[model samples]
Target: MDTTAAVPPATVIPHPSTAQGATPVRHNLVSLRRLFWLRWALLGGQAALLVSCEAVAGVILPYSPLLAIFSLQALFNLLTGLRLRQHTGRGARPGDAELMGQLMVDLTALSAILFFTGGATNPFVSFYLPGLAIAAAILPWRHVVALAFYALACYSLMLIEYVPLNLHNPDNAINYHLAGMWLNFVASATMIAVFVSRLSGVLRQRDAELNLAREQLLRDARVEALNDQAAAVAHEIGTPLATLAVIAGELRADAADPRLGATRVSAYLPDLQTMEQQLELCKSILARLRDDHETAAPQRIDAWLDGYVERWQLRHPHARLEANAIGDAAGLPVEAARVGQILTILLDNAARSQLAAGHEQIPLRLAISLDDHGTPPTLTFRVTDRGLGIPPAQRARLGEAPMASMHGGQGIGVYLAQSAAQQMGGRLAWHDHHEGGTVAELRLPAPAPEPLPAAPPPASPLTTNPR
Candidate 1:
């Protein structure tokens, strides 16, 4: 036994993206199933009517051939049911052509049955109106029109060629069928107005809903694809980052040797440390890119600000990194990783601006404060730098990733920083300082604090230890 061949299709599961793509095909099969059941009902009704006319009413024509026609219809319905059953488990759907073919078979079988008894003279001849109405509800417009025309042809042919069952004289028969025709016309109108209107409207609505769902799935798939690409890029860059880190560490160690002149050590040690810092930062960033889902514990507002400035300074040794706490923020909660990331971006940008302007040392000021005016207190950071001022035109596009700058580089860093800040319920903005350089401000709502502990008892004089 070949194992590959033995594997059942029932065991296979398609991805959500693939399953969504196959929806339209499934819709077709659904249409076929609906049509099949309706056809079955038609077959059942035909059998019952034939029996009543032949046995109870004692009206007969050619019983054997008519029964054979009914048998053929039953057989066809059975085969269709079996075919649908086979596909049901496999989640397969029928196509438009298949559904159309099924509809045409039903109409033809109906036409033949009508021809046997009375054709156009049969009061049930108006039943074709219902069939046409149903076709309009379920089938495509072209198929609907085709089925309608076909129905017209069948009725016309029956008027000329169908066998007559003389149950009544001309006057009685005309009155009876005319009444039926009027009643059928009412039923047809009701079907079009009430049933078809409700059913077809819902079908169209569902189609539109499916289309929207597909579009959302497409967007999700594209985002997943982008994430995969990012992972590949992270893998490619990991090696270079490791190599740089090792080299920077070695350079830092070498710079420590007193064998080199004191002046030379002093001259290169900061540069080496800065290089190591940058390399470590690169490694950290790559690791983050590899896994962006790590959870970071909350940190105290002051502590996080202090630690961030310390690390951020390593990247820009000549740029001043200071945290001046201006607001009462003793117990404010802060998301350590998120806050660090946003500040890192702001500090880096300021340093770059100064360096690009050929400044040996970049002046950066970080002012931390609380905006007491807001309902819930907000933590604020104001970063100021003296560098080549941004062009007036560049202000609006400051944090736009794909923006072009006078200094040639993609503004990806600023854009990411701004986005991160906004996500944290903070805002990032840049403005040309009145005196010089740019001031970037970020404001975030401080997390609600836990209840304060009861005040500790003051130490008694007797309990105090004497030095």
Candidate 2:
């Protein structure tokens, strides 16, 4: 009897460098769990203190009401921990919507509890500010505004309704008591607002810096990949170029009499000339590849895509190429060389596959756009090919294995493209195009930089020869 039950299929886990949006969600969830535990511990300590106060002072301190409130808060904390554990354990990230919802609920509950337990009169009400601070630091501005409103409303209500019952005694001055309570409320709220606003600003700055560092990392990765490819390309072309050079040398050296067999000599002359020209082309290609290693400049999207598509068409003259731009190309930020390299690989693959299938023409399309809904916009570059679409099984493994042995058994180009995307703080995703082919989408965050003085116009053609 076979003892082996079929194993479940493995899930695709994106690398931290390549995973977008999800990384922050995972980070937020983990942070929330940590905060939850910290709050739980604090609440436990608060409970112990309440017990001590009730025992020694004989003052019916508000332990019962506070404990009951804390119980609900603890439940929410436990649920949050469970959700975070599930997310991290599965190697999957949480969604933004879910994260936002959790934050809102957590803040609302804490604020409500503070309002009910003596509002401004409660000594511990100030503790509630930290929760709001966390929300403002991580959430978008709109959500931050919502939290601000929640804080204002809760504090306002607490100031109006809370009144100490034993104010007529010789020791108690109701007016002074009310005045002190209002003063404390104003002070705590002011401190919380100032601290949270400042803290949120600092967080935003740090997040921007993190994004820039990630982009630089991507640029380094692309440079490394280009170096490797340049080496391989040189190796591949060297032998052919050497053979042609040798043949040209021999023909020139022979110098057989043109009078005895002019026709034969003339024919050989054309062949030699053709070989020399092809050898020159090879040498030029090698020179350009070498030069690329020296100056790895950033690229403009519109110009880069246009040039790449044109060069691809030159190699496969019969292939169809299409391009579309969705964002303003004038001021976009991207590494030109890396973007071009990625487009070239995709277009080259499509052309080769089409040629192999004996098609006279293959269609290729590229789209570039930006997503502006969030604080930092995201840039999207998509390349689609109307050729043999990748199978689901193979698509699943596109970026998993060493490019050399992925599902379709192709390597280098695809691996480099994927690597370049990640190095640039972006992701490379492959899906079936709606019109019956494969689409590769690269997504990156667009963080605006400090404005610099304009430089001289670029000398190189906006688009290079599509080789």
Candidate 3:
């Protein structure tokens, strides 16, 4: 069957347009608030540092004019904090470009203050490099370049003004100091530029990969939903097709006057049988599909498996069935229907494979057990058959791969069986049996159930009133 044609196309809403109107107000508010808090914390830290520096300088170096500069930086931090709060309160977020521009403006003002305090000769001038690094991290390439140029211009102006002045030194030490400062600034700027650019590129690549994975996941979900719908439709038509087959057979036998020739009736009989078989196949497919989503209240694993084996034996009367509990599986609790379906699929597959191979007598063996290594236990089911072992090439594609070419003339029974096993948080894997033929094993997590309370004793019956 062409599953795509049987199922309708799924309507997908893109992530950006999932919310109609209202501008995604909640998300925008959250994003803005998060940014506001981050910026406020950073600015608050900067303010504290400036205030501490100002206090220390005022006490130790009372005559030094740099104390005023530190105070001015502290005031600027306080103002930036207030602006951030206001922006957050209004539910407004500054665009990336605007934020970068503001960072550049703040860095430039700091650089100017540092130059005025001690020019290139002051150790505090080294602090300017950190601001430049921050700018590189947050700003676009063109903006970073523009900021770098502005810093260079300001440094040059400070050097020109300080070199001629003999405020601290008699000799012209400012020239040598200016050259060293310029080299440090250039080196820091280069390093920051390289680091930030590489980091941004890595983030962009990771985002692209995540987006591709999400899209692929959505597409797979749509395809699976389509398959489920097709299975349902096939199941619904099965009974009617079976009825038609019965009627066709009766007509073939009763037509004795030769209104329809024997050859024509014979040709129609095979087609009728084929249709009936197709209907049965459809019913099986639908059952497997339903089993994929089945969940049942927890029950003892051994009892479930034993009961299932008994039911399957009735269905395949000619097959010899052998079932055994290997370990503590009898007491293990599990979702009975899902576990039963998985066992049924495995046993049915083994039986059918044996019949297809023309085995004189079909032998189906099943083993149920548990593996308890640590806190959680694992339930295991192993089904072995004395049939033609799956060919090496075909065994490789038994799980999720399409089995059209592997099955040759047969339909998709094996594929659906494998799918049902996996949907139950288990796996179906085929291997050669010890003596011969094939064995498929399924493993699932043991269900954990809370202990039930003991029941109360029943009371004696009361006398009934006269009618």
lDDT of 1 by residue, 191-227 (tens): 4666466666667766786767767767776566446
Using lDDT, give the best candidate's number.
Answer: 1
lDDT of 3 by residue, 48-162 (tens): 5445533433212222344555556556556656766766678665555655555555566556555554566554456556556655655567877877887777776776564
lDDT of 1: 0.63
Give residue 235's lDDT in candidate 2 (0 to 100). Answer: 39
Query: Candidate 1 has which clashing residue pairs, if any?
Result: 29-94
Candidate 1 global TM-score: 0.47
Ranking by lDDT: 1, 2, 3
Q: Which stretches in model 2 have alpha-carbon errors above 4 Å?
A: 1-22, 54-59, 62-64, 94-116, 163-280, 293-467
User: Where does the lowest 10-residue lDDT sum fall in candidate 2?
Assistant: 1-10
TM-score-based ranking: 1, 2, 3
- What is the alpha-carbon lDDT of model 3 when measured against the actual structure? 0.55
> Which of the two candidates, 2 or 3, achieves a greater TM-score against the reference?
2
Candidate 2 per-residue C-alpha lDDT over 321-391 given as tens digits, one digit per residue, 9 for 90 to 100: 66666645334646655565566556656655554555535455667777888666778777777666676
